[model samples]
Every structure is written in structure tokens, then in C-alpha cells.
Target: MAVGALAGALALAGCGGGNDAGTSAGGAGAAAGGAGSTGAVAVKNVDGVGMALVDSAGKTLYFTDQDTAGSIKCTAACLGFWFPASGNGVAGGAVAGLSTVHRPDNGQDQLTFEGKPLYTFKLDTGPGQHEGQNAQDSFGGTTFTWHAATTSAAAPTTTEAPPANTGGGYGY
Candidate 1:
């Protein structure tokens, strides 16, 4: 099937040395961020999806079914296509429920939404692209179903807004 082939190719690409970007986990939830990460997240009204969390570049954010409250399943070959979304802000996107999770694979904090790890589709050219929504793929023996992150959480009580956009699709 085409999906299988694409997954295979992506997995192979993962073995080609390094990624297009140096993916890093900054932080998750209220947890503090680690070194080599600067997370800046915001909510944007995308075309296909209503309001979704976006990176500094305004690229729509996604979450995987494989990632749980305490587990980060997208690793190794998976990182090629699903660039991790890392940020230090506990309050995500003008709303509460934003946090970080420490990734055992890489020893960094990964940003999460209401406990689910967040990611951005590498294939998406730019902001407003929801190509990753409902997408099915596999890498490194792990199957993943991705969906756009929804901005449905209640607003945070604090007045501090998320950090200003710094202009990188994947957390830089």
C-alpha cells in the first residue's frame, strides 16, 4: 500500500544521519524545560481546523494516539516525520493544561496538551496545513495516528501570555 511505502521511506530517511531540524524536547506541563530548547506556542485559526496550537512559525500542531500522559512513543525513526513540539510554558496557548514530559529516549522535556505529547507534521509546507490530521503511519515498529491539537481547554488563571513567537516550525 502507499501508506506502507511512505512509512518505509520515512523510516529509511530517519537512518540517513540527522533530521532536517535538530528536534529537542524543552519541557512538558508545569515541568521546567531542559537545555537546547526554547518553546514558543500559540493558538491560530487554521483553515481546515478551527483553533489549534501552533509553533512560533504558526505551523499547526498535532498529537499522536501513541503518546500518553506519562509515555512518549514517537521516537527514533518517528522523529523524522513528527518533529517534537517542546516548550517551557506550563500554560499553553492562552489556556491552562499546557505542560512538559521528560523523554526517556532523549532525556529532554516534551511539551504536552492536557497530558498528550504534541508534534508538528514535517510534510506540511507551512501554517494552515492540516495534512497530518487523521493520518496513519508507522515507524520503528510503532504505529501512530495523529490529530490536530484542539484549543478547548479553559484559559489559564494567570495573566501571563505565552512567549512571543520566535519563528521556527519545529521548536528551536
Candidate 2:
């Protein structure tokens, strides 16, 4: 997909991936593609995290230090606050290292970047929020260090909260 098109897709899908699972559809990050779809995965600068992978609604996607490669480690209680980002996991444009994995819990495809399972934080009510970054928590016998998924190695500089739009939209 073109750069602008990817951003638009990310915007539509951005807010859709919240606690609500509205409707099911097909696409990367779009197991459900209505108002609550995960939409598409895209690279964008999120507040406090710099250039990183975000969901359709601009919510920062993260990886847990406790997770095994290609396998999910968070379950039950942990899942309540951290939601798996459902997607086909193919992000176009300058974004690379995109992939997907099947979740045994729900039979849905979860998005992964650079081989780490990606998730969104429930406290982040909107896009571009990185409320889960560097958070330390334990669930299901695992201790997790949540970190934002980034495409760069430069030190991230926190910025003002992202603008409301941030390019995410609904539907496909």
C-alpha cells in the first residue's frame, strides 16, 4: 500500500481496537473491521515512544519481555489489561518485520512485529497513547516488561499527546 493509504487505514482501524469487538472482517489487524476493528498496523510517532508500530487507531503496540518467540505468554488476568492486536500482520510502506501468529485463546490472528507478539493497553483509551510502556507486571506466572515496538534505535523523546485524528479510520 502507498504511504498515505496506509496512514488512512491505520486511522480508521485506530480506535476500533479498543475493548469493544464490534464486527469481524478480513485484513491485517482487522479480525473485526467495524467500529472496534484493529484495522491495519502502521508505523507512526506516538507520544513518548517516537517512531513505533501502532494499531489502526494510533494506539501504540508493544512486546513483552516475558513472551516466548512465536508464542503468547500473557493469559487470563493479564489479558484483561493488555489486549492482543488482532491482524494479518502485514504492514506496508516503510514498515518492515511485520508478521502474525495464531492465538490459542481465541482462534484469531494477532499482529507481530520483529517476531514479538503485539498488544494494546486498555488504559490507553485513544490512539497514540503508550500507557503500557516500561510497565512491570506479573500474570500467569510470568513477569512482563512491556516495551513499545519501534523501528528505530535512537533514544525516544516524549512529545505532546498526539492530535485526536492521527490518521486512523473505520472499515477497511
Candidate 3:
């Protein structure tokens, strides 16, 4: 198997390793994707990421492979750059796959999509910046690659190779 395929397995293998599963993502966050919202969260077309979910301030939401259905590998120093989305931030519309889960380390609730926890990047300071895209970070001992949260329930099937790590990975 390819390295990507192998790592994918390890990611899934680490599932249910976080706090007890809160409401299933399917139950709490599951729904058809939409472009309506009056507060909290809404859909926006992001550069490079296309139609993705954004926070009230328009910060892009992201997830990581290091996290599983009920697991969150991003903590500690990892949070220095990747901030968790507030669980109280409702999609406020018909947006699908949006929900919240309680953080095991901190009893506070965090938002999630498709069962994976959501986060906002501190590096994305300017409008339309997604420096977090594919940025690798290690939490504890697990490594993660960040990606924007999309409104669609189904991810695009791709065969392209991941970009080269010429810039080096996140060491924090």
C-alpha cells in the first residue's frame, strides 16, 4: 500500500480513542449542504478550497487526519496555532455535517463536521488565506495534516499526489 493509504489506516485505527462519543456526527451534524445562515457559521467560497464552511468572522474551518470519529489529536502546543471552533457556534442554517463534540481534555464543547472536530488557523490572518492547508503539525506524538471543512458530505475522489514537503513540516 502507498504511504498515504497506510497512514489513512492508522488514522482510522486511532478512532474512538478520544472522550466518549458525544452525539454521533450523523445525528447532530448530519444534513444536506446549504448556503443559508444567519449567525455563527455559514458557507463561503474560499480560494483554493472552493465551497467551504467558515466561522462568523469568516475564518476557514479545518480538520485533521490525526483525529478520528471520536478522537482529537490536536492539543497542547498544537493548539498554539490551531484553535478549536466553539461547539456553541451553530451552523445557523441548513448546512449539512455540522455539529459539536465535547473535548475530553477540556469539558468545553468544540464544533465538528462529519464526526471530525473543527478548528481555525491562527496563520490565516488575512482574508482568503489558508496557510493551514496541508500544514503538518504534531500533537503529543501523533502527526496531522490540516484541511478545510467543506459543506458537501462527500469528498472529491482524487488521484493526484500530495504536494511536496519542500517547505518542511510544522515542528510545533
Candidate 4:
């Protein structure tokens, strides 16, 4: 029941207005595409989860069970919690399976891992936080399960931190 309550509260927060951050797909995309920005995808060692996919800011990225290849089902209110990884920046390092999917709604390209749409959880406080792992919730009438992005069938360890974009706005 507590899980339900938390999901409800988060959903409500997603519905509220005045988000200066702007819920538009373009808000986070700009920072993701700025000049001198390095590749957006990287593999890092997360606290309990070992190795997982992280964005330019070293924040954990996730894949949803409800989304399919080349398409994203999360939109409108759903984008509130699950911010799509912008399909900008070069694929630095040797991170494999990095690609982008064309979002039909706003024409914003969303980053993909192994053909799966990628997203970051809004509630995660910082890097190494896998708060959205295995989370089950429904938003905009869609039910989905979220999981951390892993390098392969098994998680690998990497000492390097993801590239940093100091001017970017999508951290924490």
C-alpha cells in the first residue's frame, strides 16, 4: 500500500504546474546538445547494482518494460517522472548499442540502449542511486516496470565517470 501511495504522490507531483524546468521535450535536450559536450552514454559502477548505464552527468539511466524499440509510450504526464535521455552527444568510450529513436510527438530523438528506450528517474537524488530499479507503476493509464541499464547480460565495472556537462540542467 505504501508503494501505491508513493506512486500516487509522485503522479500528483508530475501533474502540478509551474515547473520552470519546463516539461517540454526541448528543455533537457538543449543542455544535452550544447557545444563541447561529450558523449552522453557511459557505463559506471553503481552502489548496489554494480555496473549500469549512466548519462553525461553520471546519473543512472533506465529502460521500461512498456516501451518497444524505436518507439516511446511515455509522454505528457508520463515524461514528468521518466525523462527521456536526449539523443545528442557523441558516443564516447566504447559503450556499445548506443543509438537514438525518433519520438513522433515532439521530434526529439531519445537515446536508446540495445534498441530499448532510455530514461532517468526524477526521484533519484544523485549519481549511483538506482531508486527506479524494478519499480512498478502506472501513469497516463499505462503500467510499466523500470530497470537499470546494464552493459551486457551481466553488469561490468568501470572506474571512469561519465562525461560532465557543467552547463547542463538535468541533474538530481
Candidate 5:
């Protein structure tokens, strides 16, 4: 009887692992406050690197750091602005070289790139709204900037000289 009960409990747990409430066990569905769902977002090659963004079911309100390498320095008051996405606490599926790591300060798993930590901006509100891209801010004379993904294909360069200006020049 004891063994039978244990098997039933395990089955129940596995069945609950796909809904919003079951997300704690690696389920799907979004969280409150317009955050992303625990479901794995489809990753595609954006330029040369692998990238994933919030889907239609999920709101892109949080932001992650694109420059930090394997270390999440955001915590305490920082979490209030940029909340981390939860659920099985891992970035699931095959996303090229993307992976997850634990934030020692909060015990939350964070997505990493080449072992470096990544983050989202607190101000982003939706998908395709990449206002945080290439953004630069200065703190104590140190400049922090978002990194842009590079394309794997080579772009064409202009080789011809520019035509002469047709408009009149203005001078003081």
C-alpha cells in the first residue's frame, strides 16, 4: 500500500507540471504582472547569436543585461524593477549555446551566454520594442551599454563616391 501511494503521488506531480500553477515544476503559462510564461520561448538566430524574446501570450516588461558575463549583480531593489522569470528555473529547449546559472544572492536561475550572465531592462514593455538595445548610461564616470547581436552573414559595403550636394550651404 505504501509503494502504491508513492507512485500515485509521483504521477500527480508529473501531471501538474504544465499549467501556470504547475510551472513551479517546469510547466507553461505566464505569471502575474504581465511577466512571461514559464513555457520555453522559441529561440532563433538573431544575427550570429541565439536569441529569444517574450511571445504574444507573455508581456515583455522586464529587461536583462546583455553585457555582463556569467554574473548577476542585480538584486535587492533592482528586482523590484526587473523581475526575473520563474518556473522550473531554467531556460529550456535548444537555444544554440544559451544556458542557465544560479544567482548566489537570490538563488534564482539566470540565463547566461558563454558563461556570462544576461539581463533585461526594467523599462521594456513589449516585444519588438527594443528601446533598450544599444542604450548607454553613465554611472560614476563608467559607461554601461547594451550589446547588439551581430549578424552571421556579411553585409554589403558602399564603394562608390557620393554625388555632389545640390542644396545651398548655410554659413554664419
Candidate 6:
């Protein structure tokens, strides 16, 4: 009886080893595809506008138009469309006044300037395309828009001018 019990315990230990092997294999697969690995953002000075963050292949990342710091108001579905570019671990260097902001939700380091969150558009599949820019109407009830960063000293400005009077005579 003692020998039988010892043999059964050894069998159980072997079964546990098989489970561990399965887990390790699963982890290896995930790491291979860069699924959990974070890619770093490369920030550079483009012209004189400000600092812009790009991917490893030099793709531009979009910034929120709002002028705030450390807080990103985008949540839920908005996050689904515009995903933040993440760094592997280290904070990247600053450029054109923009700095790195760590996002707690995804453990990704996002580029921020004047305290706004940065993102890349899902629709933009190529480099140098600022598809996220001026996308204010995409999300209903959300007042978010994209702003392209430039190294230029003068920021792009848009002013609402007064409506012009139509000179047509009425009530004749």
C-alpha cells in the first residue's frame, strides 16, 4: 500500500508539470507577436510649431486640441478608435516642449504637450497622415478634436468672424 501511494503522488507531480508547460508556451506565443510588448515613441521637432511624436518608422501621433495637463478625458468608445502609443519602459526624450505622460489604464506612455493626451487614428494606416486631425464630429456627445504638432513658432489660429449682411432688399 505504501508503494502504491508513493507512485500516485509522483503521477500527480508529473501532471502539475504538464500544466506549467502549457502556461509557459502560451506566454511565449504572446511575446512573439509583440502583443504585450510596448513600442517607444520618437519625438522630433517638425518645423517651428511644437514637438511631434512619431512611431519607430516616423509616423506622426495626434494630440488633443484641449490645453490641459495630466488628465485625458477620452474614455469608453473614444479610446477604442484612437489607441495610445506605448513605450517599452523608459520615458522618451522631450521635443518642441512636449513631454511623456504615463497612462494608468493601459500602462502605455503617451506624449503630452500643455497637458493633453496623444493618440493615433485607427483609420490612418500609413506614415505622415494626420487623419485624427479635426475629427470633432466622429464621437457623438464628445467634444474632442485632433491637433497636429508643428515646430512653427506661431500656432495655427481659427477665429469665428461675424456673419456678413446679405445686401438683398426684402419686403418690397
TM-score of each: 0.66, 0.65, 0.63, 0.69, 0.45, 0.51
Candidate 4 residue-wise lDDT at 139:
60
Superposed Cα deviation of residue 25, candidate 1 (Å): 11
Candidate 6 or 3, higher TM-score: 3
TM-score of the candidate numbered 2?
0.65
For residues 1-172, write the lDDT of model 5, one tens digit per residue.
5334533543343234323232231111122232323444333333322243432233232233533545455443333223454433223444454456776765657555445454444445644443444444432223344443222333322345877676666521
Candidate 4 per-residue C-alpha lDDT over 13-104 given as tens digits, one digit per residue, 9 for 90 to 100: 55462243545644443433321113467777787676788887777889998897756777655665777887455445667787888888
- Per-residue lDDT tens digits for candidate 3, residues 1-172, read 3435534543443342323245323222122221211238777777667777788878788899888657777764455456777745555566667777888766657877889888777657755566676666544467788888876634533566977777666732
Worst 10 residues of 3 by lDDT: 29-38
When superposed on Cα atoms, how far off is each prediction in RMSD?
Answer: 14.1, 14.4, 13.1, 12.9, 17.2, 18.6
Each model's lDDT: 0.67, 0.65, 0.63, 0.70, 0.40, 0.49
How far off is residue 77 in model 2, in Å? 1.2
Per-candidate total of colliding backbone pairs: 6, 18, 0, 0, 12, 9
Candidate 6 lowest-lDDT run of ten: 28-37
> Candidate 5 — which residues are off by over 4 angstroms?
1-37, 44-70, 85-93, 138-143, 148-172
- What C-alpha lDDT, on a 0 to 100 scale, does residue 125 get in candidate 6? 62
Report the lDDT of model 4 for residue 163.
Answer: 79
lDDT of 2 by residue, 28-124 (tens): 2232322222778888877667788888788888889877445677754456566777766445654677777777655677777778888887656
Clashing pairs for predicted structure model 3, backbone only: none
**Top TM-score prediction, candidate number:** 4
